[model samples]
Target: MNSMDVVRVLARYRFSYTNEISLQDQIEAVFKYNQIPYKREHRLSDSDIVDFYIDGVAIEIKIKGHPVAVYQQCVRYGSHDSVKEVLLVSAKNFALPDVIGSKPAYVYFLSAL
Candidate 1:
C-alpha cells in the first residue's frame, strides 16, 4: 500500500475509544481492525528493532514524554535501508526537530488519539 493508506489507518486510531491504553497497543489494534498485517519489534538490523513495521514504514512509538531522545530514535530508524519512512508517535505533543535531515519522517501527537 501507499503512505496515505498508512495515514488513514493511523487516523482511525485517533478516533478510537481505548483510553488509558498505550498508543503502541492502540496502533496494533488499528492494524488488526484494518486487517493490515504488521510486525512488532521488527528487527531492522542487528542493532535496531523498531516498535512496529507496517509495510515499508518503520513506526516508532514514544508515549511517556517527548524528549529530544525520541527524535534521535526516529533518525536512527530512518537511516535503516529496510525502512523507507519513519513515523514518530507520542502521547505528548512535540515539534519536529530542525535538521532532522532529508528523511521521509513524520510526527504524530497522540493526545487526540
Candidate 2:
C-alpha cells in the first residue's frame, strides 16, 4: 500500500474500549490486519526513531498532549531522506501543516471515526 492508502486503512481502525491493547499495539495490529508491510524505528541516527515507517511514509502516533509537538515531531521525521510523506496520527484534530521542506505531510485523527 502507498502512504495515503495506509493512512486510510489505519484511520478506519477503531481500538477496543479496553485496557489490554496499547495505542502502539493497536497501530501495529491495524497495519497487520490490512496486510501492509512496515518497519519500526527506521533509524536516522542513534536517537531519532520514528514509530513506524511504511510505504515511504513516517507514521507517528501521538495520543495525548497538544498537536503542535506531534506536528513538529512529524516534521523532524519527514526530513529523513527515505521518507516521502509524514502522517501525524493523533487523538484530536489539528490544522495540517504544509509541505515541510520538501516532503508532503498529512494528519490523520485517529478518533475522528
Tens-place lDDT per residue, model 2, 61-112, is 6667576776677777877888888877666676566687598887776663
Model 2's alpha-carbon lDDT is 0.72
TM-score of 1: 0.78
Name the regions of candidate 1 deviating beyond 4 angstroms: 14-21, 97-101
All models, RMSD in angstroms: 3.0, 2.6
Give model 2's clash tally: 0
Cα lDDT listed for each candidate? 0.71, 0.72
- Per-residue error for 64 in candidate 1, Å, reads 2.3
Shift of residue 95 alpha carbon in model 1, Å: 2.6
- After TM-score superposition, what is the CA distance of residue 11 in candidate 2 from its true location, in Å? 3.2
Candidate 2: minimum summed lDDT over ten consecutive residues — where? 12-21
TM-score of candidate 2 versus the correct structure, residues matched by position: 0.82
Best by TM-score: 2
